[model samples]
Target: MSAIMKKAWGYRYWVLVILWLVYIINYFDRMAVLTFLPFIQKDLHLTPVEVGQLASVFFFAYAAAQISAGFLADKIGSKRVMYIAITVFTFVTALTGVVKNFGQFIALRIGLGLGEGHHFAPAIRAINNWFPFKERGRAVSFFATSWAVAPAIVPVIVTSISVSFFGGAWRPVFYVLAIPGAIGIFLLWRFISDSPKEMIAKGKLSKDQDIEEENVAPKKLSKEEKRKAYGVFLKDANFYVFTLCLFCQLAVYWGTSTWLTSFLVTQHGLNIKEMGFFASAPYIVAFFAMMLGGWLMDNVVHRMKPVALIGYIGSIPVLWMLGSVEKGNTGLLLTLLLLVGFFVNLNFGSIYAYLPKRYPKEIVGSATGLANGIGQLGSFISPLIAGYLVTVGANGSQDFSRVFIFFAIVSAVAALCAVILKEKKVTKVPANTIGSEKSVS
Candidate 1:
């Protein structure tokens, strides 16, 4: 390869590209279960409540593991942590096909969650390490789009496999989707470097070039320093507010995404194919909104603490309308879902930008893990609640109306919380390890 091309695909860009691809596979494997849920429900003779419990298995494991994963990422290298995580989940997800009963199915899903739990906590840490302060928002926002895109494409792909290639066997769909994930493991193993120091050494690049390449100052922390870093973050009220806001956001976000497909089929008379297309539309809107939100949030950070509060508050009406719209008016329902998905996702970018902007780099990963971990609990609860509501109202009546209202109220509360978050100036960034370079008053 020419030097120009080699420089273009240098270690920095290569790491980012491969990690992004890994994230895409991460989301695809995790969300494959949702699209397959209706079939799983029928085949397993499970009730709606039982299905909700099964789905909750993923979140239970995910939420429970975040802190430990964050701690591990801080101790071990994030790349090694991620590699182990991806391998664990990929194997378990493939094995999900072989389960013969609900008990075994739930067990496998829980294991899937445990394996996948290590991803966002450490991946966010990796991004925070690699990207500069100004560019981190866009970097995080772009990766966050995996949540949007995987659901959009994976459903169609998995549905096709489930229907035709597998002779309508959901088990075969699980097995097939696991193939690409295994390939991702090999890619990560070959290309992923743990830190900029390692990347520079392995690639035979100058230390100065590596620092300039990633726009990061080389900072190494000891165990005590890492502990104190997290300690500082834990004592900050701003972190608490961000965590609470994220928790509420998760409730509404997952509540809608998890159930929207089934809602279309049961209440709006959408067939499986139609439901797949429509379900993907909102996340498509969300993809653009997240990108836009990240850009706008950074531009206006000094002036507006609640940069995406409008989007969050605005979603209440949109979500309420989503569940209240007429069954025959698919256009109107689609509009509501699309807007809700857009604004709800916009909050994701805004919150990520907001947090790191206000906090120092030393504890960015730990704070983010705590917030995102707490948020995962909301993810755990929302779908299970929706499932119970649907099960009890299963006499063909749309009971999800009240559920939608609940999320609207929860989102409104999130907006209010967003307003109260005090944005502090991140005064100093230490060069190597954590110490009192400059003090914050």
Candidate 2:
């Protein structure tokens, strides 16, 4: 191997690390609001329904933007899309501190959602660009852990800042969180490239054995061919199944994550400081769970469907237990919540690994975006439904039984969808024939 090739290989893992950092900031900005909800509620005199609407508005905008972002990433490049998204979202996150009323808060949430909505697909596309097929699951899972890590850390950080630095003021917490994201904009711009081809073209890498072997260029497709590929994706039954499975999983995920802190405070009688600390427990467990899930997918199972099936099925009982546990049984509740976290996230790496691999590189971003976009509708609706279910009674208490049942049912459906999902087998045709052909069971 030439010196350039060796250096590029050495730097490949750093790319994953950088993206991981970006994801941490991405989720930190997204989830810090949840920790601040109680303060925001008091400050703005907003009802639970309206608070739920704030989260819903973000998801609505987020879901709406995914397809366009994915298409744009594929057409232009992931690097550009990611840089623009991080910058826009960082600015929006800083502006989150400035909203004084419900309308202003909702508008800022919408803007934040629009900015962040573009992040996932492009990040996945970048993973596809960097890692080999066999290693992608582990790489993607490592990236996915930001979901757990951000929540685990952000709640503590935001809550601490709210209590200490801002005297329980939530706005300054937003401003503090936005700074790291602003810094990330420069790091990404300086370090990231769309593909190894760009590096080679720019003479950052030479045509050497190690680099050449790892950086095989993807097959090019004409515009008509690309359109046909998208049509095939739409017509395929597996696409619907996968997308629905993702939708159900996200429903369970966002439903629980969005409301768990409030539930702890209201239902379990934990104070804000206690809620912040305990709220992190589940995701703390989930951090390791997701890492284990990723490693298993890459090394042990080596298939997406069965891993997802097991995860969704396993989560049902735990979620039911979480819902049924007696109020004030904080110990049991936290345990069940942790188990639910573990099971629910087992599919994180597998889903990301599966979707991009199933489609042509030319449309991988589109397929990923479509699945995530449609799936995020679950994120949009689940919180709203939960809010409606947990209606504040005359005594100012909520009955959480119905909400728990809803999440359990959603998880059960996700497991069923996983069971029915058919993985496509791709066969390379002759070099002179069309680019590739895929057959689905």
Candidate 3:
């Protein structure tokens, strides 16, 4: 083997580290807004319903963009899609600081959603390119840690800056948060390739070395062939079940993430700083929960449905306990909320890992995109429903009891959907199948 190839082989894991960092910044930009919502609501004189509408609008645009983004990733390559998405969202997030009215705020948020929506499918494809199947659950879960880490850290960062440095102004926080994304774009552009084949072609790795032997790259397909493959996905019953399961899971997850701080502030009477601290408690537990769940999925049980079922079923009672806790019981409240976070996030990595595993590499991006896009409807609707529920309470006070119960019911539905999801054995396709216009079966 050439010296350069040996070096490249040693450096393969570094690609995962870079992707992990990008994932962190991806979520940091998204979740930072959650922490800033109270400040934004006050500054714009918006009602709780309006605040919820803003979040819902972002998810709507995000959902709408997913399928197209997936198609684009499959066509142009995940590396290119990820780079463009990172650049677009970072610019939009910085522009968020300059919006003056609700109209402009909504427009910029939609733009941010469009950009951010392209990120995940491409990231999943990239992981599939870099890691073997057996290790993918752990790798993806490690990447998924950004979900927990972002929420845990962004609250403290945004709250500290908004209160201390910006003197309660939230605009500058958005502006400053865009910086990491800018750096991420540069790193991804310089370091990332679409697949190991690209690296080998570029003389970065040896042709003889079988770094990814277990997960061979799929042959490129013609446009007609691509359409036929997607048609097969449309006809698959398991696809709908998996997508529906994700929809239910995300509905409960996004609803809680979007409104948890607001719930604490208005319902529990906690101040912004106190709210930030308390809100972070659950995600801290979630970080460990996600890691443990991923480890178990990769090492012990290979099926995602059972793990996801546990997360959803276990979350129901914890969510109820969260809703029932009295205002002054800080310790008990935090404990219940922590469990809620743990259970809700337990399947984060496994679900994404499961998607690509079920589909051939040629259509994995499409499958991921379609599932995530349809799943985002849950995120798009749940916050809006919760807002309406909270808004209808007496004398402008929000009744979170009803909202919590609603999420519990949603969790139950998600758990049931999980029970219905069956794992499919992936079949190998012949090289001759790549150019054929016939539907994949």
Compose the digit string of candidate 1's lDDT tens values, residues 258-282.
8887788877888967887788888
TM-score of each: 0.90, 0.92, 0.91
For candidate 2, what's the RMSD? 2.9
lDDT of candidate 3 over 52-93, digit per residue (tens): 678789999999889888888888989889988888899988
Clashing pairs in 1: none
The list of candidate 3 runs beyond 4 A from truth reads 1-10, 162-165, 206-210, 214-216, 391-396, 430-441
Quote the RMSD, in angstroms, for model 1.
3.2
What lDDT would each prediction earn against the true structure?
0.74, 0.80, 0.81
lDDT of 2: 0.80
Worst ten in a row by lDDT for model 1: 432-441
* lDDT at residue 111 of model 1 (Cα atoms): 88
Clashing pairs in 3: none
Candidate 2 per-residue lDDT over residues 1-441, each given as its tens digit: 346433555556777889999988888888787767777889899996788678789999999888888888888788899888998899888888887899999988988888899998999988888777667788888899988888788777777778998788888888887789877887787777777777667766554444534344456667766666676577777889999999998999989988787788787788867887777788888877777777887788777877898788888888877766787788898788878888988888778888765765666788888889999999988988887787577998866777888898999999889889877643332234333555532
Query: Which residue window of length 10 is worst by lDDT in model 3?
Result: 432-441
